[model samples]
Target: MCGIVGLISADGPERLASRVAAMNAAIVHRGPDDAGVHLAPGVGLAMRRLSIIDLSTGHQPMTTADGVALVFNGEIYNYRSLRAELETRGYAFRTQSDTEVILNLYHAEGMAAFARLHGMFAIAIHDQRRDELILVRDQIGIKPLYIARHEGELLFASEIKAILATLPCRPAIDPQGLWDYLSLRFMAPDRTIWAGIGKLGPGQILRRKLCSGDQSIETFWQADLTPGPFDIGRDYAREFADQFVAAVDSHIVAADVPVGAFLSGGLDSGAIVAAASELGHRAFHTFSISGDGAGGDDELPLARAVARRFGTTHHEIRMARSDYFDTLDDVVRAFDEPYGDATGAALYLLSQRASDHVKVALSGEGSDELLLGYTRAADLATLAKVERRYGPMPRPLLKLAARFVSPDRASIFRAMAEGGPGAYRRGMAAHIGWTISDAEKAAFWRGPDMVPSFDLVQGWYGLPDTAHPLAQSQQADFGTWLVEDLLMKADKMAMAASLETRVPFLHLPLVEWCQNTPMEARIGPPGQFRTKAVLRDYVATRLPDAVLNAPKRGFPLPIFPWFAERLRDAGGYVPISREFHNWISLEGLKPIVARACRNERRALEQLWGIAMFDRWCAVYAD
Candidate 1:
């Protein structure tokens, strides 16, 4: 909803305000409605307000009478109740703004109160009396926060570019981060492609006591991955449906400004729109992003149908390959990294279009991760069973099949043979991502530190921590794929367009409800193999048969044909750049490029990934 920036240092308050102004200027798109700055002896805080809540009074660097300044970048869905509690404690009223409530609550409870709040927020609170800076991100990381510690100054912001304003030089690429992206298609959450900068993981808090120049990072809350008992007979589906509609109602009502939704023809967004309309909420405006047969699904037809049925105003934006290519420069720059997901390109354009009419938009983002909605979950579970039974393929056989089989399948053959959680983890990434085999990757970097996709999150949310294979994959995704890539892409694209996108599915109350879902309902029997089975059941009657029975072609941009055409148009195989030689190896790059030139679908992603990284370098590095 807003862009928040803070720089705490011995960098003289006078100079700090000037530097903060420049930094805040970079992210004006995030909050074009209003701007404010707070500067003191040891720190400066800034925020761009979009004017969503309490439009008359909602402004930031919202300060209290006691000298505490708060700059936050999300909605606290439960702020009203939290306000009531604070009022009971005799807290004086100022504005009917959540920002005021947050400052007052922090005044009452300090940083410890973050756990008691539920919302998608990136909060930076500066306590002048304490000379302390505390940064908090929501439990699921729906909002982004990047931090950098340099030359006795600590910088934190809603986007990486704002942080880059203070240090314009491109940060060096971390070899480990590159290796991780090569394996998993995304960098680790705590790590970014740029060196000397770090993304604060979801549910994390960073506190810098400027007096002592001491800082530490800790999780304010953690996911309860412990499976909840799924009872189909106990009206749980009805409960999920009711709570989900309530969540939809809550998100739309958060803003005093006109609110809209980023809708798709898919069941997720359709379901939300229907729920909103049925709940008799205010006039609903819907937005959809479609593709121009350039490796993307055109959901306009169905999106229009749903919007019409719900009696909501609808807008559609169509994107072509050329459109994507043209905007890609800005897209990668917005990413500030080599994000492998092309959906970011479409999302960037979509948010840009949506921002024209509305300031806030609801989206269907976390549904897949929460409900095991991807079709691959069943295959992953099946592969795990096969691994458990046959004890994996021989290494020689895995290598032999690597050249012929799909990259995902080849990974299963290789990783499953190794056995245990690592295999399952690797298998999960293989199911959804494109990466070369370990043997193939070794030719690029045989360093002792290269982490395999299966082992991407060994210490947290990796395969070893969960029971079911589906659960294992979900955990891995929630930690890596969702946090590092999907959420990052969503935030950047939306903020770049100056639209505040909210995810109803990620509402903690709704997520906690889905966490109790049974494995059977998630992945189900292969013949049926219905993903999000409980959710499908809930919407079965509320939605049209066309929607309920539609195939899941989520953001299905026709990228293979586009990649093939791009390579052919460029005079056959694209050559790897000198940067690739510096980081990866010509030894490994040769065959991958060769395979892609041969029109191998598996190899296309690698070539595209390299090109994306180069494009990012073209902007930030070179």
Candidate 2:
């Protein structure tokens, strides 16, 4: 519920304080309620507080008598229990803030204490006793943290912009990070768009020995993707329902302020609202975004239906095509890193509306990746089976036949004939909607080096070979796409509005259970092929019949029509900013723009991706 920044440098305390103040100023939107700075010789810790847990006395950078100091950005749901345990151990607390709980827990257990936390956080702890600085991100990366070292200074911050604020100059663009963004629309957790900066992955810890200036990073948690034995008679629906409701309760109650939710037409958001209602949590606010019929489902009616069912105060934000263009630059600037997802713009607007009513809002973000919610999972599984049956066929013939297919289907057809690592790479590329093929990439990409989507995590595709394809896809996405793209978007867009958004589905307990769920339960029967069958079954009675079976329309934005309109407005040419002149090929983008102007959907999508990247360069690179 705040933004944290710190530096371990050789600068004098005055210079350190001044630079840290500038960093804090850069992220005032993240924590407008309060701000604090702490400097100790060679180290400085700073934070901008949103003031959710302890408004009056939770001022930080909180320090101990022994000189251990902490600046934290996030809420710890299990703090109350941890506080009671610490108090039993004779540890005295001066405030009821979760920040104090973490500081005390660190005192008692050291690094092991982080494993016991059950919330989203990015923490910076300066241990004068150990003469080390420790930085930790939450288990699922629901919060964000960036780290960079330049000219003998070690810096960490909640957002990249904060780190950039302390920099003497803009860092060069990392080509691999840009390629990853172009291939997948987001960089991996370990990488950022800037060359020298690094992002802490989920469940990761980075420690710097202030004395020697040595640094090390390690992961403290990982998804248990290993499938468990299925007991057909165990009533998984009821079990999932119990834990899910408990998670909803946990997230909704953690904040002292009123909590609201994002309720789209999709089941994920709808189920969150239903769970809150069933638990007798009444009068809480809910928010949703409806389209102006540019494209995608008009989610307002379904959202209104759930609101009426729960009798909660519901707010709706309507988005038009013009809104996308108007706020495109703001959304790009908010990310700092180049991000191409248009849905972020929608969420940005929605979060602004929610901020009028509540400081914190809950959304069902991690459920789809945890459970098998997207059709791509089933499609990939089916593709694997088909590939196995067609393994012996001539590869070149299939490649030739692929040329006969439409541009959209060509890559998928080509991917179907390849097997092993190559197949997974191409399949993943297609899964993430990569509009540029390997052949196409070779033609136009002038960047340093391009990374395929599957290579985002070295040797990730080789793991858990015995798991079902569905399980593999689910696990892969949980690590890469979910943390990097979806959760990152959620954090940046919501924070841009100064609204703290929580994801109940990403609760560690629920995530662990869902990750180990049987493949058959995640996707429905063989012929019906429904996604997220377990979730639907769990909410069958709790949600309205219409919502129970509603087809999933993922935070869809009318990017296709929007891109076409943008191209038409620009006289059928993609506007390439001078910032990207040396990075991407205008000659290579010509055909894509031409196709977009003709209203080709995939071409339009690709154009949207490039256009967003252009805007990002204009904002950040310029």
Candidate 3:
């Protein structure tokens, strides 16, 4: 894994080296093992290498003998296979690095080489022959790639801050992007918080011709969700288990250095360890994080059970409220954007702990999005059925009920009353319901945009072009939230600690197959209410029922209650008070803060969102 940056200028390569060097230096934490630069007449590419493979010879900004150069940031698990294929085609390679495999494959197959790739990557290949720069992100966008265009030049980087460092220009904030962040907690693709810079959407590729000044962006791939004509119903549980185990085995086998797994008390991570153990890889190292407070503590016992069962080396770290308060700046700075996910703290802590034992760690992310594993999905399905029956509710009555009712319960009623496109959009915005007032929402958001968050899901469910709702939802996520938000968090937090995180469950083939499977097939019987039912069934055979059936307590954190109780104590330490004192109404925050201290669950998430946004403004906007 590594961080890459490049500047393409029509003005020749005079300051390119110094500019690229400055950009790469900003994200040196991402790749501290080595650094390399490739400078040409009009292009400069710089890379910081973590050196997971070909430790001695894999230094990058790697170039072919013929002058084609490539800067890459990710792992190509199928490099060995691709190398063998390239060899048959008369291409010779000097190194075992996947970077070389990519350069050779590009030389041999052109853009078609992307179709053959099966790993996570964000690649920038400069074709010296064509004077063109080609940028491609992985199919699922497990890695990040950001680009900005300025005065006939294009700047690209693994992190936004790196690009900002080189240009030293602050673009206007995109209003829609700001709205999305306030409502959804993160920016969507095709939009960045910074107006001029845009994220390269997943499954998409951008190609620029330096000579002709032409640029084209297109979707190179997508998960196939069309159901197959024939049905093969032979113990899907066992078959899925076998396939999952094989996928995890393949992922772990690719690491050139010591690797480990992040073991939460949930089935996702536990299942990975169980499968790895059964695959004969003993002595795997596992890491877990726990909160010190009473309400936010973790189930370390469950994690210990899996570790003991497999006899793996287990490491646990306990973090107090003070630790979270103190590290807030580090976490916010690591993410170049204002990310509102509280789990960022937990992920950062976990990665910091894991980096001590291994260079790479297997994680269980993307499973929730692919498998309908969130409670909101099940809730949306139930509400959709109700909305179909109650299609004629008066707006005023519904609005009145929404106001008097608690936000948690009101969310359910709102979901049922607001049908069609609006329902899904509202559901998507449910997490940040505190951002706008009813009066303000009426004035600001309208038409399709005003539709509930679930409407995005509904659009997927009712896609005129697609048949599978689950698959459509996955596609939407890949386009919007997955890359711009979740993957950003994963990459930044892991790279912050100089650790590599691989998600076997996010393998393209597995996702493609799951997309085509019917929702019924994936979820099993109605009313089961068990998200990821298919995977759960697979886990049932390989893991204890307790692990498989445990409630999904996602990377738990105590931010809300901790802030409520400790805000005054953290006054001097908190980074936001100076700037936040101007815009945010602290008086308005009192009720929410009071509710959080009283242990009102739903209020806490919204309260934390406000606090996070406040701090973000202090750091970035103030």
Q: What TM-score does candidate 1 get on C-alpha atoms?
A: 0.90
Ranking by lDDT: 2, 1, 3
> Over 4 Å off in model 2, which ranges?
376-384, 387-433, 449-454, 525-528, 574-576
lDDT of 3 at 363: 90
Q: Please estimate how well model 2 matches the true structure, expressed as its whole-model Cα lDDT.
A: 0.81
Worst 10 residues of 3 by lDDT: 457-466
Q: List the residue pairs that clash in candidate 2.
A: none
Q: Can you give the TM-score per candidate against the true fold?
A: 0.90, 0.92, 0.87
Tens digits of per-residue lDDT, candidate 1, 289-408, equal: 766773335567777878888888888877777887889889987887788776788889888888888888888888898888875645766656765664554656655765688766
User: Of the pair 2 and 3, which is ahead by lDDT?
Assistant: 2
Q: Is candidate 1 or candidate 3 better by TM-score?
A: 1
The true-versus-predicted C-alpha distance at residue 312 of model 2, in Å, is 1.4
Which scores better on lDDT, 1 or 3?
1
User: lDDT by residue for model 3 over 1-622, one digit each (tens)?
Assistant: 9999997886546677788889999999999999999888888888999989889889888787777899999998888888998898888888888889988888888888887888899999888888889899889889989999988889999998888887756776565565556555666556677878988877778999877779999888866544444356656566567668877987888778888999988888988998899999886999988787645346677788889888999999888887877888888888876777787888898899899889999998877776766545555575466456544666556656777887655654564355432353333433312343433333433223433433333333333222333444555554456566677888999999999999988887677766666565566655555677778876776666667657777766566667667644544224354655543455555665666666676655655665676677667766
Better of 1 and 2 by lDDT: 2
Cα lDDT tens digits, model 2, 1-622, are 8999988889987799899999999999999999999888888889999989978889998888998999999999889999999999999999989999999999999999999999999999999999999999999888999989898889889999999998999999988777766756676667898999998888999999998998899999987665677777777777789889989999988878989999887788888998898888897899988667634377688789888988989998878778866888889889997776768889999999999999999998888887777655557566566657655667777678778977545654565455432353344443443455555555567876565644444234433434554566666677777887888889999999999999999998888778777765677656656677788887777777877766677776565776677678888765547878777788887887788899998776666667778888888887
TM-score, ranked from best to worst: 2, 1, 3
Give per-residue lDDT, candidate 2, residue 1.
85
RMSD, candidate 3, Å? 5.0
lDDT of 2 at 456: 46
